[model samples]
Target: MKYKSQQIAYWFFALCILLFALQITYGFIMGFARIGWDGLHDIIPFNTARAVHTNLLVVWLLSGFMGAAYYIIPEEAQRELVSVKLAFVQFFSLALVGVIAIVGYHFNYWEGRKFLEIPRELDYLVVVNVLLFLGLILTTLFKGKRQTTTAMVLSMGLLFAALLYLPGMIWFDSQVMDSFFRWWVVHLWVEGVWELIMGGILAFLLIKLTGVDREVIEKWLYVIVGLTFLSGVLGTGHHYYYIGVNKIWLVVGGIFSALEPLAFLGMALFAVYMYRKGEKKHPNKLALFWTIGSAIVSFIGAGLLGFAHTLPQTNLYTHGTLVTAMHGHYAFWGAYAMIVLAIISYSVPNMTGRKRFDKTAGHMAFWLSNIGMLGMVVALGVAGVVQVYLERRLKMDFMVAQEETKIHFVVMLLCATLFTVGIVMYMYEFIRYGKPSDEALEPAA
Candidate 1:
């Protein structure tokens, strides 16, 4: 069932790793700056580092998702990619755009928007790149012998994700109008269609690693999708509550935001139930760990913690504070980042024909990274709570409150170093796998 065309994914994954390392570097810069270590303030100020850090997170995760698509679509569609050369072209174009954008960030050549900062000129190129990506994936799926639900769901997610980007691209003079539509892109992506993407990927991994029936796994997927749309779309109202929008959003947003956790809960329950029910245990235990861990941690990070502050009552105080950062870091790590690493863990072995699944370093990478991230989350959560009390409730000066939280950033940095070490171990394994070969495409004995 393996296709030679899947080899192209390896390159995208390599790019993903490179960008991720750079993201961590910038994250460290911000972390240190918080702790009064501003050695690179003149050359690369905190604002520039923040932009690079966040944007790189988005780019690298997209790269990983694209790699997953390239690998999964061929196998699920039961055919080779429609155009490997064009795929490579798409890959290189993506990397080039990302490089230009990240480099431009350092020079202040970006829009000041939070997530959508790559400016309008580069936005056009992004649209084209995504269109090309969609065209290839959809064409291959349609032309293939059979289009399974997993393939269709994954494809639908990708297509919808591309369409959703349009809202962020539109220009608006009013700050109210801009912020309103911005949530359409930001809130909707993470809570809405992106969940579809996560569900599809999770379904695929569950089917493979757990040896579960596709019928059963995909049935859970249908429920997950239903929950996601039902809650996530309306949940965008939560952002509208304080943003000069109508008051109706307060009620609407609170209700739906409360309901949002059900979608992630459904995902978590589905993964766990399938794992316990399955008879065949695949040897790729590390992938299983990540797959299962993604499901569980997402519920905790995205579901519970998001519900913690998303209510209008709570969000009023926590908005624009480090509390938001606490939620964001863990949610992204659990929902998107871990899943990407899971797919990489699963696919890399198959592509390279090397089964180093049981390495102690692999286990250490999983545990150390998870532990480190949890520690960081705790540190941020503690800092955020103190900030809320000092700055928001007590009306203390923001700078003074930030100074009070300096010690927490030191704790965050210590944990971040551990996180970086785990990632380095992961990169080591990826490099050790070397390149994919034609022999990998041949049937196993």
Candidate 2:
């Protein structure tokens, strides 16, 4: 018998909850050190924090994506997964790899690339990506049953994201060439492949949540995918500005990336418009949060703040300041983290066939986490501005100014602590009371 969608989704979301909790823990350590908490540095340093944060995110997202695949593929293909046993093997195998990579990272055995740091198993990531693509595609294509729906289109992006890595990873030397292709794999997955997946999933979700016509949602999905390719590939230039690329790349990159947010903003407007037209209200306000929130936040981070720094002039100073962190805070949480959570809200209940969650708890967690993310993003941006003011414009030495702003770092820590508290409350609620009712949970537009 096929497993219920609720079962698959909820279990996966539970994993996300756990991952977020771990993320906060990692955040705390990094926040402490950033604020001059030297004592904690010895025990858990920058690399350790970066690895934990990035790895945990990958694991949680993979789990959620798998659950999503299992849930939707069957219905779309008009068949069960090709092999539940294979699914288990794939899951366990990937998890095992993740564990080893994380452990290696903790002990300083990494290849030293953000989002590309899975130890020496760069090939393993390739293997896993290919496995996932085949698993989903072959199963979907089995028995001549196919529905090139939004969900399927998104899966294709996932598959290609993996395939792209082959070329993206090829280089003369591992170090120099590795960093070059590393962003191809990393940035492509995040800003490119995953954007498609998130859009598809969110569309699948909105269709279920609000009674918006599937046709409308699918069309919107196509537009999103097109925008992603248009901007994401060339937009990689933004990072290259500092990585020794031509000046023209800087200009082209900023323009494309600036346009990236417009796509998201379109999504937000589209979803909200649909929600308004829908005749009824769904119980999953939180699911809508990520779907819509991702767009708005992307506009702010990728669009506004990105525009702020896109200029060669501004970037000269803001390249590595807290402003960058500010962008990171909102962009990832809003674009990536929120989508995952939104997936949880939409599919988890369906997987379990139960909707017994504490709405108050979920909403509480939602608001708190939102507050925390906002605080962090704003604080980081402000801190960045302060740094630029002192170091770049004033001709002050970086260290001397840093010593002066030690208190400001403390404030950032406090902001992060507050943020962590919010995330914890949200995670706690999800862990304690995010069970679905006695049916599939649906997404809202």
Candidate 3:
């Protein structure tokens, strides 16, 4: 950290770890429920648990993105954050809103939308919080001595993400209309603007860790940005295939969504090529592993797996089944979750002035979580295939098919436990790094 204000990112990252742990816990609850352990069914049913699990994933990832912006924006712009105090305010308010939304789920106080389950009133608070966050980021970027492409891409992603949330908040009487707009938020964020955010962060990390020139990295960033918009925007059609939309989406969605993987493929090649091209002297090997790992894994999870069922022919059978769940788990974790972890792994040692890079536990945490998640994805994928064949193909009863899949949920639970253990280890590393301090600040090399 070359600026004291960047320390504000520490708290946000800390919150991210906390919420992520809670998210895993709820995942366990649901996994257990799937196997007929209804111990907490009365208090926290499957529906509520699923909502909390997914929503927490979003909240933690958002926190990590905010933290990345706070940490990266100032350094790239060559100035301190515009307002650290307001940054703290935005942090707490964002956490408060997330906590309230999650708690409300247990009591059935939420919208029925899948990922947009947070109530409309709380959605207003989220908008305000995000606006405050963006205000600080944009103000600092403009006020600083320089504005870099890395910073602009990241800021644009955040700005567009905030704007995209509005469509989901609108009140629509028709279910079809609501679903249409909902994809604007969900698909567009992950597959669209969020890729810009990832590319920006990846560029920044590569510049620091790889000793790669900014011009080289930012050039690749432009390719990624162009690829993302070209493919991802129309990729939303994949969701519209069976959602009562025009039959045209069949061709449109299949073609465009298949092309979506090219963007991710570009990202993967960009990261690996940059890594191979750089000096590679940075001792923060863990961060490098995560940074490189995120790119390659995202291509697999988001690109390949997503393509498997993205076409109308496959999705017609796999829609709303565990197949989607399988893709969702891996894609979100690979693309968004790993990038967040990469940023955190890089920033923590810098902020806290603790040089515990490449610890045994850190390596274990990465491998375990990723392997565990892969195992879980396979479990779910197999379960989904069985489910699709049984219910959709064989025309079996839904409950009977669900009963047949209980064994896979058991496998998922086992893998999730391994995943949770990795997360706990990572969180331990986070705590061991201790709090951020001014002593950590140094002149940028």
Candidate 4:
């Protein structure tokens, strides 16, 4: 039974690695569009690679989310997963559906929505909903105790994400309607529900790894929930600004999004404050690197950039440009990637029951990924600023101005290359010296 659970966890991890590798390759390939002109359309078109990139990000994120849920539910409940059978079934079902959807996407059969780009018909979409709902239901029943506020909030968010996704999946004749609902699922997932999940997981990890009492953690959880709902429920208005809507979204999005950064920044400060106040006997520094770094960078990248572009004044320059992509890349990294790294750090040691490492491989991997991402963020940001200067300040034609700053694209491509190399090193360390020794970290395990 133990072997089976561990095997399932690592198997999902292997999938994550594969997706990460693909994402890296496509990332580089897409960069070629800017730096060079190979005319590789139909093979690895910009649109095609972008779908791959975003979809892979979602899949790999879910892999980590599920794997962590499988592990933590047991520890909190004082029982194993209700049925490892159901667990594996849920995992594989997700994988199979992802494969089918992505294959269709690769063939250019998609409905042409950004996040909701899967080409599956309504029937297949329904199957996905059922699979997700069933998995959540089973996991919840198995969890037993309902008092773990943080975990429960996160799980409920996950469940609600599944539910919210259904309405957006309804087949529509007009592509615009499809596009609208697509944001419902896309923005609402990452911006709304995933933030709750992030709070839950971050709280749990800090409590366990930082040796803080559950009481202290739960207090923080309550605050987190308060801030998330206060900010996120209204903050989603940010997307409504440019989506061809007529609901006074500019005023609404601006006000709310201006407040949204407070939530992210709050989370970061809370994590750091708690870490400082709690125990300080740090283990392998890599284990907590992303966990801690995520809080800070997410606040700055997701929160601050969101603030920068929230205004109608600024977004007119930044919209659909490299600045927006910079925000996406960093926000995803700071929020999702950092959390995923923390989960791996927390789970891999427990799964392998290892305590220490001989060399600095894990640490190196952490720095590489973190630094690479930071590099991408800064480079892209500079290019974006340059764009604003060229198009807005200079009052030049759009494409003409964009062409004048071709050097920025080249620099951006170089940044992506650096980012990819970092992910490689990080993945290498994860595959190699993941677990140190059984005797050292047994108590935590």
lDDT of 1 by residue, 172-195 (tens): 999999999988888988999888
**Model number with the top lDDT:** 3
TM-score of 2: 0.89
User: Which should have the higher lDDT, number 1 or number 2?
Assistant: 1
Q: Per-residue CA lDDT of candidate 3, range 347-375, in tens?
A: 99999999998799999999999999999
Global CA lDDT computed for model 4? 0.71
TM-score of each: 0.99, 0.89, 0.99, 0.90
Name the weakest run of 10 consecutive residues (lDDT summed) in model 3: 436-445
**How well is each residue in 1-445 modelled by candidate 2, as lDDT tens digits?**
1433324345556666776678778877777776676575676788788788877887777677666666666655655566665555665666667667767877888766667666556456647645764675555546425675775776786677667666544544645456657778777777788777777777777776687888887887788778878877877767767766568867887778667666666667767777776654777667766667766676676556666776666788888777777877777777677777777766655555546344766666667777767777777777788888898889799987666656666666776776666667667656555464544433422
lDDT of each: 0.92, 0.68, 0.95, 0.71
- Model 3 alpha-carbon drift over 4 Å, by segment: 443-445
Model 4 spans > 4 angstroms off: 1-7, 122-146, 172-176, 356-358, 392-395, 433-445
Clashing pairs in 3: none
The count of backbone overlaps in candidate 4 is 0
Higher lDDT: candidate 2 or 4? 4
